[model samples]
Target: MAKTDQAKADKKRQQDKERQRAKRQRDAEKNSSLGIREYRVTLSQTEADALTDLCAYRGGVEPYGAAEFIATLIRRDKQRMEDEKAHLGTCDFCGEPLPTGCKNGLGIPRLKGVEKCFYTRDEKKLRL
Candidate 1:
């Protein structure tokens, strides 16, 4: 069943709230290991007002998420990475040309016959 736009916005709002909570918790912890460092950005009154106005102005089919915009930022960042990778025909994480026919990491000819993809070096690493 297709969800209505209001429902989608609600879901996104809930997701944003959860992400904001997690970010806040991580940012509040002292020397936390979540790798989510909180940056203290001080803005003048006018600058703050301008940012608020911008957020309100830039809102789409959902509520203005203020500084806790998760979907927009993540989607934009992913799109940027994909665009760059496509343009260069290489992995964004590792600046190397993609394989011609190799499906997985098989040591590409450029890497001296070393086949490494986006996950070859990252998938096996310790991930929490």
Candidate 2:
């Protein structure tokens, strides 16, 4: 009975190790192609306050809570952009050239690298 218990413990340890290894591999692959950003700026107190207010007004979010909210917003936006790119490989409607994504008709802001489609009736393709 002791030997069987030991065997089970070893199997669990091996499985844990395998899971950790796979996780590390996935992380490495994801980070391998990631880009690094660098920038520098100096702001006076008044300028900072004004900027904060502007960002809040423009983003419809509070500047004081920005750090946490921005992280989540950025992550969500990145995922949304990736999903959009995947879906727009071709036009979502009429199977025409996406050129980019169809604007349909909503006045959505265009992201960099996106092309405006000219042939779709999708509301998402408006104002192209």
Candidate 3:
């Protein structure tokens, strides 16, 4: 009985060591500079159906699937935002549109009466 208990303990320790090693490996891979970050999102039934439909439509043309479709949408939105920001005279530092009274190149206003930029305000809120 004593030998059996010792053997069980040793097996448990070995399993724990293996688990720790695997966790460390996963952490290293996740933090690697070249690794692609993954995001998990929860969607409502209707939203999931819409995404599926969009993927199916693209499937008729090629092998484009849900991930590709989502990526394309994100890229399109980013481009649109960049164009809008350029048209609105976006600031170099914050990538936000310059306020009407902004004299400095920075989107942030130095004038006492001028309000803070939207990005700055949001950042402040996050900090708090």
The whole-model C-alpha lDDT of candidate 1 against the native structure comes to 0.60
- The sequence of per-residue lDDT tens digits that candidate 1 reaches over residues 35-86 is 5555567889997887677677777655466556545666778887676557
lDDT of 2 by residue, 8-114 (tens): 99999999999999998877777676853323557799977876776677566434454544556578788876776666556543344354444344544233234
TM-score of each: 0.34, 0.29, 0.47
Q: What is the lDDT for 18 in model 2?
A: 100
Those runs of model 3 whose alpha carbons end farther than 4 Å from true positions after fitting are 1-31, 90-128
- Candidate lDDT (C-alpha), each: 0.60, 0.59, 0.67
Ranking by lDDT: 3, 1, 2
Off by over 4 Å in 1: 1-34, 44-46, 60-62, 89-128
Q: What is the lDDT of residue 7 in candidate 3?
A: 100
TM-score of 2: 0.29
- After TM-score superposition, the amount by which residue 76's alpha carbon in candidate 1 deviates from its true location, in angstroms, is 1.3
Pick by lDDT: which candidate is best?
3
